[model samples]
Target: MSSVEEFRTAFRDWLRADLTGEFARLRGRGGPGREHEAFDERRAWERHMAAAGWTCVGWPKEYGGRGATLEQQVAFHEEYALADAPARVGHIGEQLLGPTLIAFGTPGQRERFLPRIVAVEELWCQGYSEPEAGSDLGGVRTRAELDGEEWTVTGQKTWTSLAHRSDWCFVVARTEPGSTRHQGLSYLLVPLDQPGVEVRPITQLTGTCEFNEVFFDSARTPAANIVGTPGEGWKVAVATLGFERGVSTLGQQVGFRRELEAVIDLARRNGAAEDPLIRDRIARAWIGLEIIRGNALRMLDGVSAGAPGPEASVGKIFWATWHRELGELAMDVHGAEGMLAAGEPYDLDDFQRLFLFSRADTIYAGSNEIQRNIIAERVLGLPKEARP
Candidate 1:
């Protein structure tokens, strides 16, 4: 086997061996809609991953990582997903903010933040979306002002994933008064534990409370907490979005493929496979999984150039649509039973949860409409959408 293949083998072996004993319960526990499962246990699993040097493998060795090559990083994620490892608690810190810090952060910033991220000692959330600014990130109105040795931030951020569980947030705020759109913003690192920060979980249709609304009323971080420059945060924030869909997406597809296979199995068990339409949809889902993986690999080529570009939108729109459809397929395979709750109050079964949560798949990272606009204006150089 090639070295990358060998790396994959070793990684897979480690996962199989380590995800046992107290950790065995974590297998297939957390992912997408199931983020609410095994609350404390999943956090422990991430710390365990850190201790085993499995967390943040893509980070540079100097930042306490394996400095794994792109191929090696992809291998680890693939193996992790195939092993059905719990969803990581530190994705925002490890994948998104860590790289952003390395690329745009001052040495002091890197020294203070990167190590904790590698250790899973701190959790993070993205403070990008707001009530008025879903896909139009440029419309962020969260404002921050310098106050002596600190920057006081005030604004509300909604649909912030895991904000309630995170210890810090990388926030995009308007730093220059009267600035609009993407300009005059600053990427500030704000602590979530302080008096001025409030986290309110937003319950989803899945009956899970993974998403949250975060209120920052004069939340303060040091003056040096801003990444890049005070008024140039939009650039850093956009780069962070590029990293948002990186090599780990290849691994995501592995899990997605597994979900598709399970739905197929469900169809066969329930006799839905006998129906020509169900079989055709299953076949199409498989083909769609292949398309996702191919696009991710192609996008990986852009990593060396510093984050995937606007071209990444092509894959985003494709996979989001595919997964959403896969959710529908899961429910269809289950027939009428998919509509029933697993328990009283608000409990949901796997397929039901998948169906409801996948509804947000197209909306979260970026809405389908937004993704198409990026492809048109940025990637294809087409005419821009007119705004009021």
Candidate 2:
């Protein structure tokens, strides 16, 4: 086997041996505790993965990582999902913000932040979406004013996932008062425990506060907290979006595949597998999963080859559509039981949660509409739509 393959094999063996004991203690019998405790468990898991040199597998060794190949990183994610390990809590930090910082941040910034992120010592949240800036990020109205050594930020950011539990937030604020959209924006790392910061969790249909609305009133962050040059934040934001829609999708696709398999098994036990139409749908779902896997491998290959491109947008679109279809198929197979939530004492309550969460796949990480527009304008050289 190749070096990458050997690493993957060893990693798999280690995970199989260690994950059960760690997860059992982390989750306890009734599942993780309150939100903070749950996040702590996830952080502990990340520390475990990092100690094994598996947390930031693709990062360079100088940055406290294994410097593993892209293939090895993909293998780690696949095995992690297969092992049913708890999802990493610092996803925004590890996948999106961390990569952006490594690429665009100064050496001092990297030294101070990267190790903490890999060790899960710092939890981070993305402050992108606002009441009016959900799909149109350029419409962000959050303002930041320079005050000698610090920047005072004031605004409301909606849909701030994990903000309540995060130690820091990477926020985009309008630094130039009269600048046009997308211009004069700056990305700042704001501490959440500061006096002027407020976070309110938004309860979803699942009765879980998985996301939040964050308000900043005269929130002050050191001017040195800016990730890149002040006026150049739009590029950094785009880079962060690319990582969010690409690498993050790879992890989700693997987890979704497991859910798809469980749905298939449930269908078989429920007699829905005998229906020709249902079989065909399940077959199509399998094909979709294969497509995602193949595209993700190609992406990893591109990253390894040091020529990353816009093809990750294609993977993002495909993965979202596939997840939505899988959820629909699960609901169809489960019939009435699929609609039941976890506390309903039903056979397929877990699948119901998956079904509900899948509804947001097309919306987050840039909406499917945005993805289609990107593919058409950037990839296919299509004519742009006229603004009203």
Best by lDDT: 1
**Candidate 2 TM-score to native:** 0.92
Candidate 2, residue 208: the lDDT equals 65
Clashing pairs in 2: none
List lDDT for all candidates, in order. Answer: 0.90, 0.78
TM-score of 1: 0.98
Q: List runs of model 1 lying over 4 Å from the truth.
A: none
Per-candidate TM-scores read 0.98, 0.92
Pairs clashing in candidate 1?
none
Q: Write the per-residue lDDT of candidate 2 for residues 1-388, one digit (tens) a residue.
A: 3587788789889877777765656532111112434566667777887777677776788987777666667677777666666767867788787778778998888998999988888889999999988967888999999999999999999988889889999999999889767899999989999999999998765556778999999999988999888877898888888676544456566677778889899988999999999999999999988998888777765565443456777887888888888878888999986555546433325666667767887987788887788778888899976653
Q: Total clashes, candidate 2?
A: 0
